[model samples]
Target: MPIEKFAPISRAACIGGGVIGGGWVARFLLAGIDVRLFDPHPDAERIVAEVLANAERAYGLLTSAPLPRRGRLSFCASVAEAVEGAQWVQESVPERLDLKRRVLAEIDAAAPAEALIGSSTSGLKPTDLQEGLTHPGRLFVAHPYNPVYLLPLVEIVGGAQTVPATVERAKAVLDAIGMKGVVIAREIEAFVGDRLLEALWREALWLIKDDICDVETLDDVIRYSFGLRWAQMGLFQTYRIAGGEAGMRHFLAQFGPCLQWPWTKLTDVVDLDDTLVEKIGAQSDAQAAGLSIRELERIRDENLVGIVQALKAGQSGEGWGAGKLLKEFEQRLWAQAGHTAPPVDMKAPLELVETRVSPAWIDYNGHMTEHRYLQVFGDATDALLRRIGVDLAYVEGGHSYYTVETHLRHLDEAKLGEGLVCTTQILATDEKRLHVFHRLHAGPERREIATGEHMLLHVDTSAGRATPAAAQVLSALDAIAAAHAGLERPAAAGRAIGHKARLATPA
Candidate 1:
């Protein structure tokens, strides 16, 4: 369904407040849906609040586009109170079948009859979940991953009594909130994604049991190798690329027989005896030595943001999986806030990038470091490129503008937490080249902090040589250049790096 036609779900209820339940609450609230929550556990409020805090931090770093005003959160005392008047409901109760059955039945009875209910069960079959529900058609499995606000994938599985429209409606709602709904056609125990994850997890446990590798080593095997590839190309496509020019058939022919080998303990179960558990626990503790869980989580979130940004940087046209989702989210945010980029100022520099100094960008002197200045300027340049139609689609067609020269003059220090903006001025442009100037200002005072002069050469990447940019791109550049033609040129446009004053004559 198109995003514009998504059901107007203003209120949602979360039936449980464990990790997954809390994550759902975060996702809903961050997307501007008021949420009512119910959990009998005493610590439920604290737990969910922590999750929401983490979600807010991650979402803040994820996109700059404006989001809707935050939705109100209500903690309800009972399941009935939680679901009352709610347009949508989600059940994240314990995985025990009997417990879920009772909880889901309660929600079904109390929630509006037309409200769609989603189960956050990792392995349970939807058919079992809907067994005795009063409104079985509205119950389906809408499983989300950890840090739900950041990850986009959701598995939507429907049971026998579930109406097809239930799945579609659930998908549309999730899509509206920046999630990708992967529909599962048939009811099965441990649906696709989890099943694959379980296989690897089971094998890792077995490896630990056999003393072949420790927990840390197994993690390294993943994060240092296929894990990176999986972020962009999943298992099959990674192999296809590894197959050289011959592709999947050659890959299958070459390695298909290896599947029968006894290299992995995927089919076997390793007993999690006390000795093994203690050993793994010790190893994990060692791996995270000196770092509190929260600190580690912050580090993890920071790394995730950087990696996702990298993926977004190389995206092409329709873009890659996660990167595409990020862009869609930015677009949705803009649409929700009725935001449009301000028109370029012909007589003044066009503000390209505006961001804050993240704590990570600070150095020993309590200010943002030098290299970060260039990084921020690069991001500003990227913004300019996107605005002028030198985007992923244009680059994917084997054309791109490469920075051939850049000169940065650092004027003043930019301290951590200060907001910064980079403004671009067109210096010159031609069919194959672009010359531009950018000025960085520190805010709330808008004091000039730095300036960069850059020259970019249009390139035909496939030919590995300089080439004329497409007519459309050149036209956009020409228009901007013409608009700024009468403006005063920057005094530092052409500069040399040297001592201008008399060289220590008194000495």
Candidate 2:
């Protein structure tokens, strides 16, 4: 099926409200899909609210892309009410097969016939859950990792009666919302990820039970060692690299014989007797070192953000793995902004960029740093260029505008979380050059925070020298310059560095 044929989900229903369900709500709402949620727990609202807050904080640190406005959220009285008009329905009630089956049946009866249903069961087979459903074709397992808002992977599993089109549509929706969906070829008790995870978990339990290592030591082993490699490159690829230039075959040959050794007790099950349970619980408490669960979640989220950002900067900024998905998501967001942006008044400066001061942009003085000012101005310049038919495709074709000279005047402070907007005026333009001025304003009052005057040269990047821009770009630039010709020039336009300002006498 062609991916473009599937419309992005506009509304969704979540039929539970614990950790996993709340995470799903966060992901859907952040993607601009309105959500109707149902959960009978007395504190369901509070739980989801706390989770949403954490998700929001993490996303603030995630990317600079312009996210669509958050979708509205409403609590529903029951599963039937929640699924009334939802295009996508997610069931996260619990892991028990009977409970899931009952809920799935309820969702099937009330949800729109065309609505896609996803079960968040960690290990239950989709076949078992869809047994009595009226429309089994649209139901599938979409198991996700913990902290569903942050983790990108969703294991999409289909059952005997599942339709292939359903899987295709699910993948399309997942892509639109910035997620990776891997379709399982065959259903099993536990899907691929958990199967691998269960094996490791079994061994870890045995180790703890036998007193070979404490919980913290075991965690440190993974986080400090192969965990680093696993973040960017999964197990197989990491092993391929470890094969030392000869690749997977050589590595397999060297390590294949070790599989026969009795190094691991794979089949052994640790009895969760009272003594063992208490021992593990005590060690876990000590490992936490008095930090609350929410605190730990935030720390984990911050670390994940840093790692993902690093990977996004990998391969000379093209991105890798999940970072690659993020880069593509940001590109789509930029394209959406361009299309949905309101028509500007050609007679005034163009409001080219609207953004908030991110957490990372602050310095020790609790204001935007010196270099970040340049970055924001550069973004404004890019927005202007994009406005005039200069875009990624144009640059990829070997031409772009390069900033040659810039003069900046700092007027006031831009603190963290402040909403900022940048307006660009084309002071003058020709086939080979563009002279532009940008004013950055902060807060609802639109107080001017900074001014930047820049001189840009059109260039054929391949030739490494100045050149005249294409005809379309020139035409667009001409129109903007003509509109701004009657406006007064900014005072900072011709200022030189180190120009002294008059000081107030004995303030």
Candidate 3:
């Protein structure tokens, strides 16, 4: 291993606070830097806030190491002011060649020569961008994806005048911001992402122009199949795996011929007729009909939160994908919710439950899904099963609770981020059957979240037949329930499920 000291990263500055600029600020600020943003746009504050909100989800997806809370983010009145105390500067000005050239010169004059300057340019060669600057070699392209805060890829391209040490410095900054810095040893037009996307986009556009496929149909093709695989693994690696027992060599040899096939031209070029553009735009708008971008963004973020949160809860030796990033995410959440840190119960349950609800569980009214009522109740039954010695290991030993039926009722909306708690009660039990009930409540305020009742059958996984809880486990559960005797029976069991119907009871 090479020996090198990891430099300290405490602050960063954004020279262009547009979407990319704001995203860069959030990525660094959330990682605990005093970010100074200088955006000429009037909506800079709102843009930054929105970007930060999206970045939070991405941050969680990227790390699990404990990171400092989001540092002080301030709006600087001028480019010079923003660079005052920054250890690094990410310039994301307009894409015009002149604009980048002018900004790079200004940054070189205003910021310290030792401080690394990174440009969020797609494909503008670093030499061209730094040509007129006093310190041209210190600047390099740190190309990032749209949601720079979440996606880990940062294409680091070098220009003729770029210095090796400066490139390394830029990589260090990318590391601090929680990204996988892929170095493009030489400058290339259109960069990596834009080129790859453009390839696909060109083909899609060709299809549209030729009337071979409509916009929605083309989108559906990607979303239904390749999108799922791409989410977990990209094209090359995915193909390598798909090569199967024969391996990539054989697979590629067989499929390589397709590369020469007359696939529609994507890069060659095509005239984007007004009619086709209108058709695609109209289709896109229709797809998002009655959707508010703000609310849609919220839902999108909420989904990201749930997915990353799930990744963080791996069985063992997991979270390398996002465990470290989650550490930074926790800090940001704490800051937003106005809390100190992720709370750990003083006497946390040795074994309890963490139930879940997916995006589909959300209703149009923006609340706890109606069917989710049943799912929550189902989770409660499992918790009770654990209490009675039917843990996962026990279930593996061929005995489990099988829900025979359920009744559900939902009251009030469970907006995104609403904290939830549930309590399980054993209504009745026998060798063949276990009757259980559970109440799902929202936060400490005791708002009615949802309710569900379930009648379950005890079964042996091996025999797949009715069975009984192990003697020891059943005894422990009976003892625990007796210790809290006289605690109100959850109202759902006594009568039906609802917020008002739920009576005061033991949690």
Give the TM-scores of the predictions, in the order they appear: 0.74, 0.86, 0.66
Clashes of 3: 10
- What is the per-residue lDDT of model 1 for residues 236-291, given as tens digits with 9 covering 90 to 100? 99999989899999999999999989888777888889998999999999999789
Clashes of each: 0, 0, 10
- lDDT tens string, model 2, 1-507? 465655588999999989999999999999999999999999999999999999987886677666888999999998999999998898999889989998999999999988899999999999998899899999999999889998999999999899998999999999999999999999998999999999999999999999999999999999999999999999999999999999999999999999999999889888989999999999999999999999999888877886887788788899999888888898998777655655789899998777766656678998888787788889889878877888777888999999999999889999876778899998989889999999999988999999999999999999999999999999988988999998888877888776556544565
Candidate 3 colliding pairs = 62-325, 63-323, 63-324, 63-325, 63-326, 64-323, 64-324, 64-325, 65-324, 398-461
Worst 10 residues of 2 by lDDT: 498-507
**How large an RMSD does model 3 have?**
9.9
Superposition error at 154 for model 1 (Å)? 0.7
Q: Candidate 1: TM-score? A: 0.74
Off by over 4 Å in 1: 1-5, 316-318, 339-354, 357-507
lDDT of 3 by residue, 454-478 (tens): 7888777788777776787667556
lDDT of 1: 0.83
Which pairs in model 2 have colliding backbones?
none
Which parts of model 3 have CA positions greater than 4 angstroms off? 1-8, 54-67, 306-415, 419-507
Ranking by TM-score: 2, 1, 3
